[model samples]
Target: MARNAEALDLVELLPRYGLENYKPNIEINLFGRLYSAPIAIAPMGMPGMVWPGGEEIFAKASHKARIPFTLSTAAGATIERITELAPDTTWFQLYRMPHNNLEMNFDLVKRAKSTGVHVLILTLDVPARTKRPRELRNQLTIPYKPGLHTLIDVLPHPGWMLALARHGHNSFANYKKYTNKKLSGYELAKFARQRSGGTFSWKEVSQFRDAWPGPLVVKGILHPNDAEKAVSVGVDGVVVSNHGGRQLEGAPATVDVLPAVVNAIGKEATILFDSGIRSGLDVVRVMALGAKAALSGRPFMYGLGALGVQGADHVVNYYTEEISAAMRQIGVHNIQECNNIVIRHENALKF
Candidate 1:
C-alpha cells in the first residue's frame, strides 16, 4: 500500500498554460473496444468481504459508466452473472488451479469463453500466497469467526453487520458449482485451497492462449524480459503490476518499472497497469508514463465501504472528473496526449 501511494506521490506533472482552450478527452480504446475513460476497476478477490455483493455493484457501475470491470477468479460473483451485468465491459481474471490435475483451470477458461468474456487476464504474480500483516492484526480470516474480539469489531459498524445479515457470507461463487456438493464458508474455502495455487508457467500460458479465442493478458509483470516473454507467448497484452505491493516486501514499485516494461515491448503488446492508483490523477500518471489504461482496486473498495450501493458509481464518477481535470491541468487534450506530458520521476526504473 505504501509503494502504491508512492507511485502517486513521487511524480509531478508540469502544466502548460495556453492550452486551456479545448476540453480534455479521457476516452480510451483497449483491444479494439472503446471506453469513456482511460480507467478500469481492477479485479479483486472477495470484494464482498468489503461490501455485500460488491462485485455486482462494480459490474453494474462499470457497465453504466462504459468502463471495463475485470472480475477475479476468487470473486464472490460468478463469471456468468458479472458478464450478464456488464456484457460489453466484462473481463475475467484467472488464477491457475493446480489441483484436480488442472481440470478446474481449463474448465474456468472454457466457461469464460462460453460466456463471451471479452478479455482473459491470467495473474502471474502470486507464485505463492504471502501472509498479510494487516489482515493478521485485524484478526480477519476467510471464514470469519465471530469471537468476542470480532464482535467488538462488528459492533462499531452496524451498517456492515446489517449488510452481512441481508447478504449472508461471501463465497467463491465460481468455484461452488465445481465442488459437486453444497459448500459454504469453511468448507468452500478448504475446497478452493486444495484445488487452487500458484502462477502459470509460460508453457501453461501458451496453452491458455490457444484455448481462449479472445484477448488474453498476463498480469503481475514487472520485468522488461517478462513483458517480452508474455508477448512472445501470444498474450495480447501485459498488466504491469506488483500485486499492489501485497506480495514480496522488497519488490519494486510498479511505477518504477513501468517505463522499462513499456520501452521493452510497448509497441508489440498492449500495456495495462495496476497498483497504487488512488485517484484519476494517478491514472494520468501511469498513462503518461506509458500504460494504455489504468486499473484500480482499493479506492473503489473504499468507496463501497463508505457509501454502500451508491459508492461504486460515485468512485467511477470521481475518477472520471479527476482524470478530465488533471489532463486539462497538464495541458493534454486526450489520453494519447497524456503520454507526451512533461513528468518528473527521480526513481523511475530504467532498462
Candidate 2:
C-alpha cells in the first residue's frame, strides 16, 4: 500500500504557461450519464470500521456531489439500502461465490439488477487474501475480542464508541440473509471469504455480462493481456488496479502499467483506474495517461476517519476544486483536453 502511494507521488504534472482565462469544466460522462467530475468513491469493504454507516455516508455524499458511489459486496450496508440512498449514482461491486454452484453469487447479481445499480463491477484481484503484515503484527482479529488491550486501544476515540453505541456493530449486511444465524465481524468475514472462491475466469465474466442488464466493469486488471481479455469478454469497462498494492507486494504501480493497458484496449473498452489516487492532481495524472475516470478508496476513508459523515462531502468538494484548478494549470478546459496535457512520469514502467 505504501509503495502504491509513493509511486503516485513520483508522477509530476508539468505546468503550462497562460490558458487560465476560461473556467475549466471538469464534468465527465460515465456509465452513459454525465457526472460532476471524473472522481468517484471507490468501493471499500468494512468501511464502517472507519466510521459507522460509512457506506451510507459516502452514498449520500456522492449523490449530493453528482458523482458515483460504488458499494462492495462485503460492505456493511445492504444493496437495497444504498441504492435507495443514491438511486442514480450508485454502482455495485461483486465477488464470485464459488460455493453451492454459485447460487448465492447469482442471487446477489439479480438483486443488484433489481435494485437498479448503474454499473456492476466484478472484482477479480483477490485470488485469495494476502498476508497483511501490519494486522498480523498487531494481532488484529475480527469480532474483536473484548479485553483490556482492546479497550485501551479504543477508549481514546469516544466518538467512535458513541457511534457504535447508536448504530450497533458493522457486519456484511449484503450477505446476512444467506446464513441462518446472525454473524458479524470475524465470523461473517470467514463465511464470506469461504464463499468468495476468488479470481474469476473470462468465461465467468461473460456469464455475468449476460446476466446483468446494465453496464458491467471488471476490476483488478494490471496486465494489458488481461485488459484485452476483459474487453473480449464483453465488459463495458475495466479497472486497472493491483488491489491497491495489498494483494501482491511486487506488483507494479497501477500508474506505471496504465499506459500499456490503455494502448492495448482503450479503444474497445472504457479504462477506469484505482489504487494510489490521493488527490485531484492524481486524478488528472491518470486522465492524461488515458483513464476514463479515477476511483479513489483510501482518501475518502481518511476523510471519514477524521470527520465522520461530513468527511465524505469534504473530500468530494476538495477534489472538485483541486481538479478544476489543476486542469487550468495544465492548460486544459475540460476532461477531454486533459489528454493533451504534458506530464512528467519519472517512475512509469518501460513495458
Highest lDDT among the candidates is held by which one?
1
Q: Write the per-residue lDDT of candidate 1 for residues 203-244, one digit (tens) a residue.
A: 999999999999999999999999999999999999999888
TM-score of 1: 0.97
Worst 10 residues of 1 by lDDT: 177-186
- What's the C-alpha lDDT at position 137 in model 2? 65
lDDT of 1 at 345: 86
The runs of at least 3 residues in candidate 1 whose Cα sits more than 4 Å from the true structure, single-residue gaps closed, are none
TM-score for each predicted model, relative to the true structure:
0.97, 0.95
Instruction: Report how far residue 69 has shifted in candidate 1, in Å.
Output: 0.8
lDDT of residue 38 for candidate 1: 84
